[model samples]
Target: MAPRTPLFRPNAYFATRSDVLFLGLTVFALYVVETLVLFYALMYLLLDQIRDAPPALESAMNEVFSTVAVFTVFIAVVALLVVAAIVHYGSGGTDTDGTFADAVSVAGWAYAPELVTMPLSYLAARREIATLTFDGSDPATLQRQFEAVQQSVGPASFVILLATVVWSVYILAAGTAGTHDVDVRKTILPALLVGFGSFLLGVT
Candidate 1:
């Protein structure tokens, strides 16, 4: 039988704190841009609906706001998972690997985080737009805005979730296979699930 490897072996050349932080910040910046684009597209769609005239701008805006709110909730939930991942890896994992680089590589598991969080940011922007449309002083406005943000964030979040599942498997397979000098095809699924689940649970 093949010798068993350590559970947490880290690569010597893996990322440092500087690298992880830099990469994280860079990722966040890109996420913000993606959200901005999605918001812009949503606004354009809403505008078209208004132009069509059967559904007044007011109604279209309301529906859009509501949708955005749901999306925000979805994003918040996913964000919790991501935060957990950061905390686990950042604090030094219990895994056999002592290097931060090993934990950092777990970032390959963060595909869902990226997919979900970007859209959440867009929904947040949409909520801001909704506020401008709605009465500022209305006692109910706060609640309405919150709801709209949640709805807007949810749908896109689902896509992110799905993508993460697929990508996580790929990263795990590739990373582990490379580490052990094994045929990658044999390890793909295990690697992917491990990578994906670890990130989601913040145990990388």
Candidate 2:
């Protein structure tokens, strides 16, 4: 049997049974954290809109919603992995000794890049939001504030977003190839498709 790969090494992270389990858990944990960060930021953004609500009540609601969002993200991740595994098998890509579990494990670990990207993206967003001055009385002022926030975030955030997408695709391809015992060339297309789909899901 091959030795386990280090968690930080995307190409070999899912190479062994223990490594697969570890990476899957790590990715899930990171997803939960990311979801929490996103929800917390969202709650801050919406706080002024819900200013009439009690502070404690609003905080509790945000916490509950964040928890639910984390579970939703977990389910989505699992569903995506299952669907990808089925498609790979149906396409006769399972000619190697790898099983459905192996494919799912690799797919889960492929999300590891988000561990870094999500936090950085959130920080960038927070910084952008801080620069905006909201005016509830004037619709035009509010629109300008929104545009200012976008302009502030556009250049740097776009570069970060592009880098994250490319890094994720590369890692997914490597993980798919390593875990499924398929040639890297054969995995690239599926990896790219799935990576883009995941990116859209995350952003939306």
Candidate 3:
């Protein structure tokens, strides 16, 4: 039997079945927190653009609830995909030395990279939003201000976004490879496809 590894080290950890439930719960919680923080930051940006914005406490609360529902659905879909991938590849003569539970656990931990990047991205956006001067009464002025805000944060935000995505893809690839006993190269395409699919799902 292979030795067990710490859950924090997903590449090695997914190979073992120890603490799968705990790790999945932890990842789920982290993902929720990350998503909430991201949406809050976005709300701050949007609210900042309104010159005479109405009291938004209620609206913000509504948005939070809606976002939670969306993220819950998104995670569920991703979990199903992970299970399908494991089953399909396992039947293809590949030595996917792990089970459905292991794939789901790994998929959960695969989100760890975002724990770092999401908060940083939110901070960057928050900072840029703070610096913007708003004139929401005039649509053209508001658009220009929004554009300026984007330009101010665009480069750094893009870099962080890109790096986090690549980091996530790398983590997912490693988790898939280790859990499935497949070549790292074999996992790359699947990881890219999954990542892209998830992004599309999130946006829509």
- Across residues 1-204, which tens digit of lDDT does each residue of candidate 3 receive? 544533345466655555665676577568767677677567666665578544654475577668776876687556655644643364332455655565666666656666777878887777767765676566677668656654454556767766766676676676766667777777777677766765544333
For every model shown, the clashing-pair count is: 28, 0, 0
- List the RMSD of every prediction in angstroms: 11.1, 4.8, 4.8
- Which digits, one per residue and each the tens of the lDDT, describe model 1 over residues 120-193? 54564454444444333443653475356445534444555555555544544443333333455544544454
Give each model's whole-structure lDDT.
0.44, 0.62, 0.63
Pairs of residues clashing in candidate 3: none
Residue pairs in clash, model 2 = none
Best by the TM-score measure:
2
User: Over 4 Å off in model 3, which ranges?
Assistant: 1-9, 55-95, 134-153, 198-204
Pairwise TM-score winner, candidates 1 and 2: 2
Name model 2 segments beyond 4 Å from true: 1-9, 16-19, 45-71, 90-92, 136-153, 201-204
Against the true structure, whose lDDT is highest?
Answer: 3
Q: How do the residues 34-126 of candidate 2 rate in per-residue lDDT, one tens digit apiece?
A: 767686675576445432345465566677786778687778677646645743663246586566666666665655666677777777766
lDDT of 2 at 22: 51
